[model samples]
Target: MCGIAVIISGVRINLSSLLPDFLSPCPELQQVDYFSIDELKAALRRRGPDSFGTKKLILHSENEGRVLLSRFHHDEVDTSAQSSSSLTPDYETSLSNQVNRFGVPNSIGELLFFGATLQLRGLNPISQPLVDSFGNLLVFNGEIFGGIHVDCDSNDTEVLMGSLEKCCSCTSLEACHCGGEGNMSVPELLSAIKGPWAVIYWQNNSRTLWFGRDAFGRRSLLVHWPNAFDSRFLLSSVAPTSLMDKNSDLDIRDGMNNLNFWEELSCGIYSITMNAPKADGYLAGEVKRLDWANSTLKELVKWERTLIVPKPEMQVFKEYSLHSNGMLPELGPQQFSASMPAQMVLSALRESMKRRTIVSKRCQQPVPVAVLFSGGLDSMILAALLNESLYPSYEIDLINVSFDNQFAPDRISAKAGVKELSRIAPLRRWNLVEIDASLSELTSEIKRVTSLINPAETYMDLNIGMALWLAAAGDGWLCRECNNDDDDCERIKFKSAARILLVGSGADEQCAGYGRHRTKYREGSWLKLNEEMKLDMHRIWKRNLGRDDRCISDNGKEARFPFLDEDVIRTLLGFPLWEIAELNQPSGTGDKKILREVARLLGLYEAAVQPKRAIQFGSRIARESNRKNFGSNRAANQASAGSVVIHKPST
Candidate 1:
């Protein structure tokens, strides 16, 4: 993923002015001082490390339409580790109190797009804020995996931009003759494109601005909708560190509640009509949501899939019947029998991983793939499935981290998982990169990690963010002896070179992998469990994915969740609850039972029985993590183990 942002307005908001004191109640009108274009670029710098580009498009309303006043582009190759090479920002349209007088102070007719690129495809890098023949501009921060045909060796951003340009009459997403049968709109074209993405489109002809994330919200897109005090409409790929302390009285926008200054724009396509009168000011863009192709499906609650009826025929396990007492029949593991549901899951997962990992790239190292391995069922299964998808000549990296000097459960399980993979694919080299960090190391980078996971304010969020951020950096020690023995092993500092990291994000939500799922089942049985899982799947993007994508991409590596594939989701939904999981059974085999069975089929016997362990807890990073923020872990743990708010900076 790349870092992309867009700011739209007539008059520029001068955010550089420093206020002497918090003298005024209406502070959003005060200054653009916090998140200037340079600052926004800085906040997103880490996510894209190859090229830095900026575009300032001047829009003038005319009798014909919104005329493009000027189009200027500055592109520079960034060789520094931090991509610190700067391109001058030209969005210096005069600021005025005209916005309040005419409509407040603002950058009204001027639109600016700033992008940093982490080039993943094509022989040459593509500088973005990409424009086409018809003047439609796009800043795309995502991969185009499926929807419309993109050549395996093509650049997705350029290809996607070309496809968008063909929507000639798409002022409203009602009619277009591109990427559709006869007519297609922005939402129609976008809905077809599979994979994770967030985009900002300038439909120059219609004076319409189109923006949205994939239905799954796999990437981060933060939106600060226009308000009375500020006429600027902003959409950013980063919310990590921008603006000042958002909770401060000085930082509050006049109309919106202080708590939600910036929101993770909900997934799905949206358009803002920009043809309103000049007096409209910040109110110019009238936003409207485009419905999904399947109209019967509730757009708001997409998880409630009434169409996906269970396929009883797909369940091959017949003997582990649940007795009336809510207990599984006493039987050995062998009696459970091989299952079609497990096979279906494995097949779908293999295809999902293949689409994510097998793509155009810059280099061919010995290792091109890595799994965020904990050696538990999900990670192990992903490792095994990825092994099947990639060639044996290419090595695989299993990055496992521990804050406790490698004694954490994840480290131990990761070792065991490697051994299991060795048994199955002896020719494949499994690099178990051990990432060890101390409390002092975490403390040193706490502010940065905290910023990266902004909008997510909890002890658990911090712990997980820190772990993933470090792990994605892939800086760790490699055991030369293939990690068979923890001690008495030769170690060398190593970092994984793989650009793609496969993670099992959606497995738990679909297969009852959490303790809460078990709790919901015990409390209200299957129906309750199903509802809880649906809720988890629906909200996982907000609670988990955005933060994960931000942290992982900051290291210039894309995190691919095979289980979260649309097909994988639909496939899992087709199975009956019993086929998905025999929750009445024990923990290791019951929770995420379908995944456990997949592991078993992959010959990962040891890993198939290991219970779920979250990244923070498994890595022991959660140990005393709340001490710095909260008084102790006690208050947070007792109330809502992972939901206690952590107050800090801008993110």
Candidate 2:
């Protein structure tokens, strides 16, 4: 994780004096420097604190003055242990081999710098990939996930280097030969990757810069072109406050003058400027403009389905059931079975928990990841799974934040759930913190930071605050419990400080725990229930990639839904709907029975079994807050309505 800034001034600006202030550790500034690239690198060092590097380059163009700056955070390459010379041929080759081993291209030099970090699992390395061949310079924020790959024999940088090499070698032999073998366009490369990303790629030859966000805005990248003293474009992870000099005659009242305006409109990676002549506008503007042509909502959905849905070859349950023969009923329309015993269901859940924790263990961070605990069933289950499977290897921190207001009905239940989780997983490993803030105050704070109206309102603000608190405690990954539903998923504030968030989505649908399934079952419509379940799953997939994922990305955190893991979903799909329905019964006596049973089998019964309370209900956010302040403003609305009535009062 790092902070990056670049200045492409129309004229030479003296940035030397401003560097120190930008780099200084200031709490108000989010420990990021506005003027100094070095200072920004230093601030990022505190986050990774293991390895850090800074690079700057000056690009002289016929039409634009470009000053490029970058900062990097690498955990594997120890900064204190090794010197700059450690990036030698043998080291680079070894890294290149690792890159190729992952099936990526070999692009050397700057490409190596960018590509090498991409292979590191669970790290978001902000980098710029520039190629002189296409006369393009590109910078990107957010993780591409498994989007780009190169052969083990090569890395991205190497492929780029090879292309450049071929271009140089061919040009030397034949002056008339146009650049082909060695030149790869940014568009071509971007289309190949599959993941969330926000990129700014500039074509120097055309004097244009292109900006775009991943279909689901996973990371926050704001563009500000202040019309104050002079119009200048600024981009940053947080708002750029340093640009607002006191002397600038810009009216802050217009809202543009205030740095807060930029934070309010978190428009991820949209181009703010395109310098194209009126007559030849299309030609120069074509490359630099925000190209959503490749990023339509439909296209993104297709890409998402391809990446998330598992192949038939990877279906574990189908093979397991097949081996069990006709004894295990076929998982189709005619094969509905009665509810399984709680113990049997618990066994399956334990296996799922074991699998997800193993995957999470691959994170390179030293500290155990934290969970944004809400005392709800989803989060409680997640906490339990981690406790049983990942406790010894990684320390699990539980951050339980709640609002104390008239809105809370189950406040006691929330507290009890927290105590229960601690009891089940030992307080020594789980540290729980409770926050007391009015919903109104939290709403104001969220508005102050993000500008946009949080869909979850105060609840969303509390979640973000909890994430920031966890980040402060040296935890970069904070787990959240967001089911696959659009509403549940919408509550996630991706712009929060946490880099990765683990969500428990898809479990309910796969397990037939949704209300729709119950309705169908009550109606004695098993076929309808099965169809509704499939439809729900499809909806989950679409909503995650389309609405929820994009919203989270806008906040800069990558959301990983362990429940949505193809293997898990496939297994749950085979289970009988009656069994699932019985498991999710809202009995006041205990947790959701089936899920708890599964948890119990995995030795996580205590964690998995919690009253099935929705996150919003658990957080105590007023479902009708939107309508609460309505009557207070009724007189004003009536006055305005009468003013338009054009009639005198009948006094």
Could you say which candidate leads in lDDT? 1
Angstrom error at residue 82, model 2? 20
Off by over 4 Å in 1: 11-31, 62-108, 171-181, 240-259, 279-283, 294-301, 304-338, 359-361, 627-636, 639-641, 648-651
> Count of backbone clashes for each model?
16, 40
TM-score of 2: 0.48
Worst 10 residues of 1 by lDDT: 16-25
CA lDDT of each prediction against the hidden true structure: 0.72, 0.38
- In the range 1-651, model 2's lDDT, one tens digit per residue, is 222333332221222232333221111111112334333233223233223332222222122212232222122233441133433221211112212222322111121122112222332322334344544444444443333553422333334333322222111122324465554344434444434455554444434344555443433444443233332244443332223333123235534434333422232323222332222111111112223333443343332221122235335345535533254545752453333434444445556555434433235543334455665566666767667666465555554434443135344444455567656655434443333344455443333232221121233342443333332233222224432112323232222223444555565665565555667656755556666666666555323322333233233334445555433443444444444445224542222345655555545444455555544445443232222332333543444321221121123
Error of 1 at 376 (Å): 0.8
The candidate 2 region of ten consecutive residues with least summed lDDT is: 23-32
TM-score per prediction, in order, is: 0.85, 0.48
Cα lDDT, model 2, residue 223: 46
